[model samples]
Target: MQLRHFQNEFPYLVKALLSAKKAGRLSHSFLIHNDDGKLADDFSISLAQALACTNPLPDGDSCGNCVVCKQLEHRTYSELFTLAPVSKSRQIVIGVDDTIPDTMRWFRSLFHMKSSMAGGIKIGIIYDADCMNDESQNCFLKTLEEPPPSSHVLLVTANPFTLLPTIRSRCQSILLLRNKTSYEDEKIRGIAGIMWELMSSSNKISTAEECAFAMISISDNLEKFAEEKADVKWDRIFEDSKYLEPPAKKRLEKQHEAAISAEYLKMRDSMLSLIHSWSAQAYMLSCGIPRDSIANPELFPRDLNVISSIDPEKAYRMMRKSEDLLQILNWNVDTDLAFREFCMGVEFGK
Candidate 1:
């Protein structure tokens, strides 16, 4: 429950804060850029605890004996605010719509309240800053322009370039050093985390089926999104893949050590492509265009028109199943050929 989550989990802000604390320098606004997986997410939350804790060590550790410390361990702390991109569960791309005036109002209203206990700092953390659209970023910019005296904003993202240039310039940014931090490496470890959990289920076949379906849904949307918005860059996903250094790269290469095969990696690649496809499909469907109108094999088109032509709810269910399967696949699975069975399970009528 403490900041020392794991030996490898180096909650990042330790070094950053140490440098700033020693230099007697701290920023009112911060944008933390790094690779995905829960590493950055976990680190961001821990940093919030460390910052808000009234009882903290000079070495930047929280006093585990305090009420605030107990609150953080159980995720019931009032002073902490967390926002992240919409998952497949929401079926909404995290865009301007998600960050409306009402949304900001909701968060601001919460922050306006006094701390539940004495001497705790209020903290705001966004899990994916890059997911915010231009307008939404503009909306947030106003919030950052006038942060509270006892408040700090920490934004986590794999791709900061997608953020508004103005927004990037305003915040103090923390870049995860390659060798220095595993907080940014979300490769094999991430996939492993997902797969191990899935393999533990009572029905491995159904679990695998769900993963296959979810990947297709994700791929369809990503592909469609790419096609519709050429200006859009999935630079983050690829950057996430590329950010792997010698150690991470070695881990990926040593998939066999983890009981993952080459086929598993291929399926993972296919899963990425499928998400790209789903992006394109999502854009088209949202825009009221026929899925078949833009049928380019190189492009990702869910043919949502065709799929929904039969049963819209059924098709949507498939997407949900796909998401479920992906979650299960996150655990220990043979990356090489495991997805073939998964993809086949999710294949539906044309």
Candidate 2:
């Protein structure tokens, strides 16, 4: 997609980037973050095109029809080097002493090569950069600190906090609009249903206990879901590596475990965000806000009678509790215990 397509949604950001580029002040390195990975990916490509487009519009956006723009969109440009997690473990590793594709070493070698286009600049994009292991990140850090001339590196991630502070401090940070949690997953929708039941229940103690147990059960199911998805991915990798040495296979198993953990955490974070959004919306309803104005209006209690029964002060307190629950979950606290505490502490109804 071209930069102009995003102008309506990200006017300020698009304008600022184009203005900077026009003035020859664009940053050499950028850290672009967004909860929606696909959006970040598209935006990064658009930004790259804007910087390298041979034909730019009067508004300073890229002419999407240009050869350079088409090459960038297709990721076939000789000067564009891209790296992402391609392993079953979903990690970008510091490769073997010899360069291997998708590894940090290989990416560095390609990026540092003489520009394939005369007097052209190179663009290196590391999608899902947070998946880079510590060693890989450190190896990439050298490129960031002393980058090749006439080059730009874009580090794209949904979780920037996982990157080292040194790496973060070196790049210009661009955070895109975070899309709301998707309820398309049946498991997520089921969890939201349980939360709504807990909020609408009149018997606080009994409902809390029941909801806590249900939440824990669903949480366990989410882990299983992640494992099942990871297994499908690992099966292909395992089949290809059947001839590998035992030690190498063992390392692959460990990486598979990490991939499962990463998958589970992604789902769990979405679940938690939904919980927080529901509580905040409930508080808004209590304060006489229109249901249509709040986030995820369809996710709110549909019964008008139930909506009118919420106590403003109680709902506000519950919203605060949800925020605290989200914060505490980031620590090393026990997941089951945290859910139980959060469910028990929530207040609902008149």
Candidate 3:
């Protein structure tokens, strides 16, 4: 409904803004940090409304009845600039380009326009801020250094380490801690969570978490499955190799199949890497480190019981084997054999 959605943990962030409004201490820039996709996105949108709310509730959130709140909800507010990178297709995509989109145009025309709501703040939300190209970052740096009054720039990132130090130094970072409960690399744990919720329980999931888990499982096993058959390679040159080449005469068709296989294998290896990363993240998290810090704290909050029973070191060894399986399979090995080996060694095959 409003920023209240995050009232539990980071109630202080809102409280800080509200306090600032009372004491007038709002900063020009905020670097909102989190590894979680769900929270960071919501925080950015809520911050936008909170800064621009023309009416207020007693609890310090925007009054839904206000004109500014309506504009934000409908996404028609001119003051809000949500910039991300454009893909090669020039279509807007996340983490691809550096330019805060429309920053230049806003400066050009912004001076002539009146605030949509009286005495409202202009809000700029930049997701995937690390994707800024050199040119785009430079352009953004100009605006960031000379921020317009009554405007707040909230830059959201999962990987702030990859961003320029100059940019990092300029903004005030508000690290959002997530995974305070169970910790694993979010993506990989998500895969495991899907599996646990599905296979570990009889209840059904409407979102197909089971399907996602199976896809990830297959991907994780693919490389090891191929690697175990390192003794074999298929050559389509000889008469006996005709079947290996798939008798279709079209060269493009053959290439297409090869591309599909390549892509599939790459994805599979990614799952393996993700598993290793996730376990490591859990381990780290289990040790009481802030999940807010690392971009890839694969051991953030480990299953300490698993870590104690299996040990983090052993888990890491398992991760390496997963990686090895993925690598060896890429060289053209027997898929089923490699797969079986990995399944046998799931979490080091214990």
Candidate 4:
């Protein structure tokens, strides 16, 4: 998508970057982060296009029809080098040999050559940058420390804490505003409904039981969804590797298992984020914030009338509790137990 497409969603960010570009003060390295990976990825591309566009719009966005913009959109631009996790382990490795593709060595070598287009900037983007192992990160860190002239590096990841503090400190960070939580899935909607009921109910004892059931249901559904997605992915790979030996096949099976676990954890984190947003909105409503100013205002709309009756201090405490729950889950605790504890511990009304 062109830069214009994101203007409505990220007007301040787009305008700031464009203004910096106009002043020839664009940072050489950036760390673009968001809970939604696709949004982060697209925004990075749009930012790069704006920097490289030969013909810019009046608002300082890239002229989408320009050859440079089109090439960047399709990722065919010679000046743009993109790297992502390619291994079954889903890692960006530091290759020992220079001939290997997408390794730190190869990525750095791209900048060593003359720019494919005269006076054009070289852009290197690392998608899922958190996948870079320690060695790979260290190798890339050198590039960040001493980047080539007229070159820009973009690191995109949903999880930024996985990156080293040194690496994070070296780049200009952009944290995108999260899009509204989507409850399009029936199961998710059910969970949201149960959560709202648990929060709003005057009878805490029975509501706790329902909250426990919702936690269990969410856990089960997350596992099933992850497994189904992994199965589809593994089947395609298995079909293409008909001649693989038994040992390799076994390794592939292990990779498939890892993929399933990864998928589950990713989805679980997303759910936790959603829960956090829910509590945050509750706190805001309790503080008398306008509905339009809050994120996910559409959630529990009918029940919002009762928010004024609830104690703002209690709502604020619940929001902090939600934050603590997220940190606790990150420690690899039992998901069901942690969720149950959180749900049961919630205090409602005054």
Return the top candidate by TM-score.
Answer: 4
Task: Check candidate 4 and list the clashing pairs.
Answer: none
TM-score of 3: 0.47
Candidate 2 ranges with C-alpha deviation above 4 Å: 180-350
C-alpha TM-scores of all predictions: 0.45, 0.54, 0.47, 0.55
Instruction: State the lDDT of candidate 3 residue by residue for 1-350, as single tens digits.
Output: 47777767765556666666556566778888687877888777776777778787665676765777888877787788676655664322323333334443343245224567566688877787766655556667766787766788888887554556567667866667675434332343455443223222222343334344464465565544444322133232233445654455456456545655674555554555554455444444444445554445343334544333334444444444444555555557875566445434443234
Give the higher-lDDT candidate: 2 or 4.
Answer: 2
| Model 4 local distance difference test score | 0.78
Global lDDT scores for all candidate models: 0.53, 0.82, 0.57, 0.78
Misplaced by over 4 Å in model 4 are 181-350
Candidate 4 C-alpha lDDT tens digits along 1-350: 66778878765567677788778788899988777877888888888888888898876788888888899999899899888999899999999976799787888887657776778878999999999998999989999999877889999987765787689778886757586666454545565666677676655777777787777787778989888878887888999888999999999989988999998887776677677778777776787766666667677565556656656776666665675677676677787777777776775422
lDDT of 1 by residue, 1-350 (tens): 44555334433345556557446576767887676546676666666666667677666656665777777666687787766656644221323433443354445555556667566677887766777665557777777887765888898887555666577668876644232221112331233323323322334566656655443444335434333333233334335668677787676545423333333454455544343234333333444445444322223224554333333433333343344444445556554343545444334311
Error of 1 at 80 (Å): 1.3
Winner on TM-score (1 vs 2): 2
Error of 1 at 229 (Å): 28
RMSD of 2: 12.2
lDDT value, candidate 3, whole model = 0.57
**TM-score of candidate 2 on Cα atoms, chains taken together:** 0.54
